[model samples]
Target: MTTDLLSLKARWADLRQQQPQSRIRDAAQQLGVSEAELLVTGLGETVTRLTGDFRELLKQVTSLGYVMALTRNDVLVHERKGVYEKVSFSNHVGLVLGPDIDLRLFMNRWQWGFAVQENGRKSLQFFDPQGQAVHKMYLTDRSDEIAYNRLVTRFQDSQQSTELAILPAAAKEIEKDDTDIDVSGFRHGWLDMKDTHEFFSLLRQYGVGRQQGLRLAPEGHAQLLSMEVLKRIFAEAADRQVSIMVFVSNPGCIQIHTGPVHKLATMGPWFNVLDPTFNLHLNETRVDQVWLTRKPTTDGIVTGLELFDKDGQNVALIFGERKPGKPELTSWRTLVDDITAAAIS
Candidate 1:
């Protein structure tokens, strides 16, 4: 190990001694380093660096059988347990459309892979060039250990270096002032949108940030939501037995859970959905803004409840589940409208 890595390990050891329960990601944050940088300190011991086309590596994940897929951003974690199936990649994008293990992967952003073993549990973790985790798949008791071993053997990097090349953090982009944005033209294009995906193009065409677009939305298109209303929305969804889509994503991957959410609870700062196949843990306290947004789609006006953190980063997006040719569920729209009216009152 280099002198720098040795010093880091010593500091990490001291930190772990002081806070044994701290997760590696949290510990990395507390130590002012990327999680991958901290993780590489155990290169030869617990982490085996892997190199190859990650898309190809992931295509072989089905052989491992049942596993737990985890993807998260700063405030929300989306976990689903299922076998990897129906994976495909086209250039820079990929998809895992399994009945249970659903994911939308952006291959171009995925840069590093590591096979990690901790406390007898194993996982395949992937990260971006900046060393932030993009996605992780943990091997369950039912997973094939032999297959996992075979995978590591096939892709392990030749050089087991303890020091990871940590890239400098990217500078935040400065968005244009609201005064400079063509708010009227943006609203017109938003009204003309036929699919929800076109919203991104609208933002780019008008040089508008997402929240700014919401702020400048046509009258009745967006409503500022009270933070307290978030819990109520969940309670209403569960009570109404409404199937919804919960989207949580980082830069490299987006995980979606499309079904009814039951068994809601809160512990400290987290609001959780403890379900049999899907789980979500949201840091409610970290949410700084909430909005009820509407967009015109060919099927109808699609609605979503959006959450954002203090830095204007999206935390999560919840929408009523509906296929392309189907209109928004009446029950879901009613539930939201009722909640919005109650919050207003």
Candidate 2:
């Protein structure tokens, strides 16, 4: 190891000794380094760097059946237990249409991967160029350990260096003033949407940030709500049996759950969905803005609750579960309408 890396590893060890319970992600933050950078210090010990076509490696994940897929951003973590099936890629985007482990992957953002074994638990971790984790899969008791071992052995990088090349994050673009935007044209475009997927293209076309777009939404299409409404929404969804889609993403991946959420709880800053196959833990305190948004879809109008953190980063998105050619669920629409009405009243 180089002198710098040796020093870094020593410092990391000392930090761990001081804060034994701190997660690696938090510890890396405390040391002002990326998680992948710190994580590499354990190379050839508990972690193995894997270098190859990640897409090809991902296709083999099915062999390690029934693992726990985890994806998270700054304020929310989404976990689901399932086998990886129906994996497909088109250009830089990939999709895992598995019944339980559904994900939308931005493959181009993925830069590093590792096979990790910590505290007797094994996992495959993937990270962005900035060393931030994009997605992870942990082995459950039911996972095929032999398959995982074989796959890791096949792709382990020959170079086991404890050094990582970190990329600086791109600069943020300053949003234009409201007066500078074509509000009339933007509203028209919002109202003219034919599919929910088109909303993203519409945003790019208008150079509008998500919250900014919400602010400019056509009449009755967007309503500002309070944070407390999140609790009510969960309670109502559970009590009334409303199946919904929960979407949580980082820059690299979007993990989705499309079904009913039950056994909701709030402990400290977290609001949780403790379902059997899927789970979500959200930092309620991190939410700086909550908006009820309605969008035009081919089947009909679609409604959802959007949450954002103080930095205008999306915390999560909750929408009624619906498939193409199917209109928005009347029950879901009524549930949201009633919640909004009650909150406002």
Candidate 2 wrong stretches, greater than 4 Å: none
TM-scores for the candidates: 0.97, 0.97
1-345: candidate 1 lDDT, tens digit per residue: 888888888889999999998889889999988999888888888999999899999999999999999999889889999999999999989999987888999987798899999999999999998899999999998999999999999999998766566678678667899889888899999999999999999999998888888889999999989777978999899998999998898889998888899899998888999998888998887888999999999999999988888888776888998888899998999999999998888
The pairs that clash in candidate 1 are: none
Q: What lDDT would each prediction earn against the true structure? A: 0.90, 0.91
Clash tally, candidates in order: 0, 0
Q: What is the lDDT of residue 298 in candidate 1?
A: 96
lDDT of 2 by residue, 1-345 (tens): 778777778998999899998888878888899999988988879999999889999999999999999999878899999999999999889999988999999999899999999999999999999999999999999999999999999999998767678999988768889998999999999999999789889988988998999999999999999878867988898999999999999899999998898898888888889988988988877789999999998799999999898888876898999989999889899998998899888
In the order shown, the candidates' Cα RMSDs to the true structure are 1.2, 1.3
Model 2: ten consecutive residues of lowest lDDT: 1-10
